[model samples]
Target: MKRLKLLVTLAKKGAIGEKVKITLRELADELGISPQSVLRLLDEMEKEGLVSKEVLGRKTYVEIDHEGLAFLESLCDAISEALYNGVIIGEVISGIGEGAYYVKQYAHLIREYLGFDPYLGTLNIRVLFPKTVFDALCGVRPVVLPGFTKDGRTFGDVKAYRIRINDIEGAIVVPSRTVHPPRIAEIIAPVYLREALNLKDGSRITLRVVKG
Candidate 1:
């Protein structure tokens, strides 16, 4: 799994199509191993038909074979499905005009915890079975945004659950720190989710909350 992860990281960083040109030293540095170790690993991978590489003048041009890519894709699919699978159907709606301000204020923590800088506002959705889902989230660990002091007042801590809506990775933001009804949920993503997902108010979408 670590070897495969290294290959995927290389592909993302240096690959164009199926081929990537990276040095043994570079790969070793990225993987935090010695060049000799990386060469041994690559030799093993090559023997197993996971990668093919040719050394040319201190640079190694590597190619992940079709079999290797297929294997990686299958692993990715399984992991994604496992990480995101609490089915909740919801309809988009407008918020109470506080989402933008709060999101802007909390943008730094969102990026740190969620791996994306969310847009200025959130996409509010009126969820079906809101109580069941909310209660489930309450029982699980969440990505916590610690409360901070701003403008002489203290902002309360917020909790988030990893979710993917319409295949876009985001989170179900439960700010129980504030007064919010159980019927509505807010989603935050890197992009303006409604525009990115081509959605409008009244459009129904699915939220897959991550299993605890």
Candidate 2:
């Protein structure tokens, strides 16, 4: 875990697939370890082909290899799968009054792909713990909502995941273009979830994935 943490720190320093100059003392301070320990860990990582280091005079350059990035990705997948497990908790929040317009545009596609006629608007939820709704939904396949152009305006594709909230079936839509933050989850159901569930702003909700 120490090695992995060190690798993560290096990646954060813009060392992925590109050389970045850094000092042992800087790395040691970031990792809360001694410079000698950091050097030993880097030696092991270099031998394992996870990182490559080049020393020129007094400057040292570091880069994360492809294998190192893959290792981090696999770790992320494992953690997401273990923590999320197709369930998400959040609090209901209001949208920016644009959900109705976008939902109207994608109504046909939603009915065709998700098998439900979505209501005019969406229910916005602020994800509780995970960094983003996309991260929380990692490892779960999404129903693709293909984009189309109308009246010279192009709409980007979206990813949807079927979920159940309080026994009401709905799907969360993630747009290719969004002004909302990663924590916001936009949900669409056959009916208005707020009225149906008696939900108000700050209402806590649990969403369970419905496997197709």
Among these predictions, the greatest lDDT belongs to: 2
Instruction: Give the Å shift of residue 200 in candidate 1.
Output: 1.4
**lDDT of each prediction vs. the true structure?**
0.78, 0.90
TM-score of each: 0.56, 0.69
Worst 10 residues of 1 by lDDT: 129-138
User: lDDT per residue, candidate 1, 69-138, as tens digits?
Assistant: 7788898778755543467787899988899888988899999888998889899888764444564364
- Runs in model 2 lying further than 4 Å from the true structure: 95-122, 136-160, 173-183, 190-192
The residue pairs that clash in candidate 1, if any, are none
lDDT per residue for candidate 2 within 107-197, as digits (tens), equals 9999999999999999999999666787667778899999999999999999999999978999989898878899999999999999999
- What does the lDDT read for residue 27 in candidate 1? 81
For residue 97, model 2's alpha carbon misses the true position, in angstroms, by: 6.4
Q: What is the lDDT of candidate 2?
A: 0.90
TM-score of 2: 0.69
